[model samples]
Target: MTPTRARYDAVADFYASGWPDAIDDPASLRLLTLLEPIAGRRILDLACGHGRITRELARRGAAQVVGVDLSAALLERARAAERDNPLGIHYIHADVTTWSTPDQYDAVTCNFGLSDIDDLDAALATAARALRPGGLFVCSLLHPCFPGGPNVSGSWPSGGRYHDEGWWQATGELSSLRRQVGANHRTLATYLNAIRRQGLWLDELSEPEPSRDWASGRPDAARFPVFLVMRWVKATAQP
Candidate 1:
């Protein structure tokens, strides 16, 4: 769950409040659900904005929860919540790409944060290094293959191919949130290969359907997958 530097900081207000704790979206729900048996676990949430997932992980039984992001304004909101409610979640303001600790985690999670980071390889390495041997890594993302419909822009700009992997802005009429901070458009193979390169092998995957209301309105997008959730595990060290 890492966000780009100044980009995320600029929209701190919109995200600090709007990105809620409860997992309402299918992708979010699937990601959290895959992060099961959370009791007595140490989890690191990368790109954690305003500690939404961090707070939830602590509430759900993560013994030690750490949230890291580069947005100070968002961390302020998260810290304020901690002060008010005391969730014991530690929030760090740092770029996930450069941040590292000798401490490892039982699980590492990033929710819709991969594309936000400018350097995909560095971000994956950050997540990989945070995990213990065979530790779990769960995440959610916008479907790579989704050629968005109606006002929503697909993974790439219109007239561009899915193979065109690079940072692109969303001009979708309904995608106001993404318009504020554009995302990197990578191919499905790129994401899979990158994770594998980081030694995080795929374990399971989910392509969740969009909400009925949303699908009903955007039939073109409805015909294709909208959200993706993936569970991966760090391969045990080779002897």
Candidate 2:
């Protein structure tokens, strides 16, 4: 198994348990806002841990929603949810980097999953390929400019802010799960360039604030943006 898969498998339970509450997260809320009027559209949800967003899309009237992730353990939770709720969302156990399909979708979404991908270029390319011309690709990520450090302090060790790449092991409160499931860091330029290389045009960008109810008592969240949401469109001209 790939290191990323193993890491997620190790903490799949924790991740799935916490995902229900993640809708209150600033990024997730923004993504939902951007996905408005999704009825009758087909959506491909990348790195869809436990089908939280996938089920939401299905509930919102998506004609079809396919969620893809690398970890079988996480997929198991997703499948269980599907069985109980029956949203008609399909779950695929495969790495996003190499996964492809002849079936095109109306939109592809990746919620806070880009940073977790080691081969972002490959993943972006695949996302582009999976979409019909003029289709949309929406994704959210930890803002590279101000990736908040450990905890909600929004503070980092000297020079830590500029780290372009490395493994970020979780520490403190939920260190056990965080340590097992680490993330990679990519520069903002890297992400933009990857989209450009895939012939995708930036349609929208947002630095969303956490919901008031969710940010309460979290001073740092109010002070800084924790996530960045972007929408890119597949251009008519192939890159």
Candidate 3:
């Protein structure tokens, strides 16, 4: 694994144990709904953290679900979760940017994982390559316009400004997390660009607001973008 991947592997245990919210995020359910994987279809959960959606897909009766991530630590948690449910999922430790498979999948998913990847474009291309013709790729990211945007200038609910210092960027467009990590910003445009570059067609885009509690804190967030869900389909050969 690359150094980046190694970082996650080393911290996987802590992430899984300490970040329960990360593993049990509602975003997984939301993204899974967009995917709508049929029974007996193969699906790939790119950057499947702690088997959140991977195990969910198995429970929903997918024939085969493969969850791949660069972090062995995260994969270890995923494997442990599978052991409990005994789902027939295959967890592979891999860097999503370069991992390749001879087989194709009916659907590919990456929930809230794209923004954290370093080579966003290369990762998207890898996803495109793994899809069968007409296969769908569904993923979610932090909303690009408000908190997720380059300019984190927004009105706080408490009568102050909540600002994040950095330039807004899209996936593969060069961005950093907390202004240090190599994570990329996954703006809507950036995502679309990557999809087109990979020869896939955009199918849908959605902005999901936070739940009641979160909304209650920053009511204005309802009017702004907080999270984005995107779906793309591979184009088929034409005569």
Clashes of each: 3, 0, 1
**Candidate 1 Cα RMSD (Å):** 2.2
Q: 3-55 in candidate 1: lDDT tens per residue?
A: 45568778998886677777687788788899998889999999898888888
Cα lDDT, all candidates: 0.89, 0.78, 0.70
Q: Which is the leading candidate under lDDT?
A: 1
* Candidate 3: residue 58 lDDT (0-100): 81
* lDDT tens digits, residue span 1-239, model 3: 45354545555655566545343444555777788745788999998878877877887899999998877778878888778778999998888888889989999999878766778888988898899999999988766555422233221212222333223322322222223323344445666787788878889877766677756655654557677788888988632
Q: Give one digit per residue, the lDDT tens place, for model 2 in 1-239.
A: 34254468878877887678346677887887887779999999999988889988998899999999988898899899889879899998888898888999999999988877888889998899999998999998767665343354221222466544655754434224445666676677878998888988999999987677646755554566667899888887655
- List per-candidate RMSD values in Å: 2.2, 2.7, 6.0
Badly placed stretches (over 4 Å) of model 2 are 1-4, 147-150, 153-163, 172-177, 213-216
What TM-score quantifies how close candidate 1 is to the native fold?
A: 0.95
Residue pairs with backbone atoms closer than 3 Å in model 2 (clashes): none
